[model samples]
Target: MIKNLLLSLIFLTVLSIAVQAQEALFGAQQIISPEVHDDASVTFRLLAPKAQSVQITGDFLPTVKMETPRGTFDGPGKADLTKDDKGVWTYKSEVLKPELYNYSFIIDGFTTTDPNNPFLIRDVASATNIFIVGGGHADLFKVNDVPHGSVTRRWYDSPGLGMDRRITIYTPPGYENSKDSYPVLYLLHGAGGDEEAWINLGRTSQILDNLIAEGKAKPMIVVMPNGNVIQDGAPGEGSKGFYKPQFMVAKTMDGTYEANFKDIISFVESNYRVKADKSNRAIAGLSMGGYHSLHISNNYPNMFDYVGLFSAAIMPREDATGKIYDNFDGKLKAEMDNGYKLYWIAIGKTDFLYDANKEFRAKLDAMNMPYEYVESEGGHTWRNWRVYLTEFAPKLFNQ
Candidate 1:
């Protein structure tokens, strides 16, 4: 009995020490960096007594113009944070919209994520803290009280690429339980992104789950493949061990990916219970993925009935080769003659590729090709891409 009491005391002492250590590491007081107010305004806080200057950069703020080799486009805005006597820096915004936003803290010229905010998303190599201001469009992006879908990281052999590659597939709710076959949407990622891009930063699964549960979108399978042909998968996911991801990867826009896309389709149709016909098939993507969607749909001519280009790169690179990149007029004409359910194109007003898209549209007009165009406010951003998906998915397989 004495030994038992002694052991109990020791356990209590160890628990107390652990609690004290945790308190010392993360402070005794809880710090809520992002406090959303009733009026839709958000306030951010950070505790760093030794720091001289602190600034917050987020998508909610007005965009700043950035000049690049491509063209001038808008980038995220930054604001200064006021420090109190207690060494806590705080910044309050006027009013934020009901959409998801990502932000980072800049301390003494170095950029860092908010320690207080646990929710984070990684795009390429950079990681940012993300939060959704509920009650509007972001509602679909949230994981609400709805029937969730299954996201699987599957691998398949690519005979064209000559390597086993990774793919992310989203099977809708009631998919596994029921033997009902569903339509498939071949959703591709942008240049720097891999198969994991749409699942993570794009919030594809959450959006699909909420939309499908609400009956806003039909239950369908979404297949996201890595556009970069050189790599088997996303960074650290392939043979490479945790290598830094870059904004540019090799063989993204080349004809290689478009030529080998059949392998992905074959894998999906064979593995999953899908309606393996053109009328029940849809293909869409953003930027380079968009370019691929355009070319792939045209090349196949009878594969996808619905095609979407969200801020797509309109043309191939100057030095790009391959028959897939050749005879664009002939390919598009063949696709138009074959007929499709919907040809949709969406782009931001200030997007650098806006003019190129306009030119592409004019070419379509010359051929009398029918296509739907949607122009939103922001330039080359995930916010616009998510919005596009919400709008695009509903129109698929409806006809």
Candidate 2:
């Protein structure tokens, strides 16, 4: 009886090993969906044998004018994929520039991300597969052989907002071992983004790690706080259960975030080893967050010595009312008088807020406020914002 039991156990173990080997071999045979070639061209593959059609859409492709219920705007251009005998669909694009790009596949008229590709990026509610073309401008966004920084998601009490808020903070490499207190950069995200926006979509940690490793940027602490006033955190992260994220949320552009901005500073100063003075402090953001940074820095003129606005919405909403928005011209003049180290403004020429930025620059010019300006090619996009950040970060605290 003992001999028979041993034989049965041996047979089961051999069967398990054979099954594992077969699974591994099958997994290895799967197609590589996003294959970045040496010439910066990309080949995307999808296995949908039974589907009638396969289409791909991404930012890399030329955009076509799309009509929506609200209005008409440029949307991602779509292209059909060619199918092979094995039921695999494939599409190869011309040479693409060095930047992070996201694409989605449409199988039988249903839009979805690539199943073969594991890397994905979530912008608000929509999620898509992403790939990187390694080369010039995108090199900083890629993680190279460098000492990495630490990113922490911590909760802090916001007495003004009357909630416990979540914040994303990045400490430079060797921060744990070193006893040095570093300067702080309060980096805000655009509308529809939360604390994780900069870290995930913006590639803040990777950029900082690469920049710091190259000695181009200083070793400073970065603090990303949720700019939305009503929400405690990102969608599904707060008390509210998993809910779909929207592009626009209430109290986004209101002065509440700016008014309560001090709470974030207080929390960071109290908890982290950072230089709490104005000279060692900097503030910057994109889109609506840029609007927030502008007002926050102007209202509290003594708080930050460096300010940046990237594709910022320079106009206040008509119904938006608060003390922070009350005396904008006066506050700006006061900010000018106080003298900041670097007041940097950058926007793409084709951005929707270009005119608003132009008007704001005119106001700054009228007041003779010293600020550096940069104009790039593109609309309001993460690509432009990432470039702005890459250029803006090196100029901070240099004086």
Candidate 3:
């Protein structure tokens, strides 16, 4: 009896070990042909060991419902994976609509990858594969020759924030003429991004230069300011990811953002030969920057005639009993209708802020305000903002 019990215990332990080993090695491998036409379908394949289950999950197909075949199986919109005679596994997914999707594979409860797709983006700690269904708008990195705009790094003193902030400005071709005074667009960067973001990551200078040269856009000055307040020195000068906590706190404070605007406006007026009037001044930004633009412009309605919010964080409200624009009173509504040539709000269809922008747009509608709301094929990325600036610039100062 003791010998039999010992033998059974050893068998169970060995089986547990084997099961763990199988779980570790039984992950799904690469995906093939991520993008497909809206009307058409594409097959996705994965590599796995025999007798293991593989499931695909993503923004399009959030649930792990479909199974992949063991070896190189093709199906419509979905597939099942099982082990083949060769000990390999594969599955194909169906055609999807035109949009950006984030997808991953699950093998025995462990998430895996699709090695076939090249377009991947970092999602915090882990990496995920991105697939685009339809064609996208013109990218900033893919710009052809147009009179290019140049970006400059400038330092400014912020008395309110008690830090020396850094700002970036984009000057169009002929800006060196000294006799020329150009309209200025004060663009703000979002959280986790600095003044350089508009030029480096956002590629605002390239987009403006290309658009201006091609006669697709009018030449204008773009000023990008570092929006954080807790940093001791200029933006991008401190430790990376260090200012994040302070930025988060400052973002919620209306006064802190107002101080940033004061510093930026003062710096522009002091340094550049810019048209300082409302007619020639504009303010725009994305995400947090969008929120800043909305509040700053509305607070000081006389400061900017063109205000743009790309994926804005704040909604439009006329009940300004305690808010920044409370001083504008009925004039806020009247000026919005007439004084501003363009009050534009743009967001991507798949962006997290799509619902926010929609709610804000509805608020504008309730107030009977005049503004332009645009929805395109993208998320909260530089691709959308670059195109937004390109399209928004020409419409400005034209009237």
Model 3 poorest ten-residue lDDT run: 70-79
lDDT (0 to 1) per candidate: 0.92, 0.91, 0.68
User: What CA RMSD would candidate 2 show?
Assistant: 3.2
Best by lDDT: 1
User: lDDT value for candidate 2?
Assistant: 0.91
Give the Å shift of residue 189 in candidate 1: 0.9
CA displacement after TM-score superposition, residue 185 of candidate 2 (Å)? 0.7
Sort every candidate by lDDT, greatest first: 1, 2, 3
RMSD of 1: 3.1
Off by over 4 Å in 2: 1-29, 68-72
Clashing pairs in 2: none
Q: For residues 114-152, write the lDDT of model 3, one tens digit per residue.
A: 766766654213456765554343433344555566678
Residue 127 miss distance in model 3 (angstroms)? 11
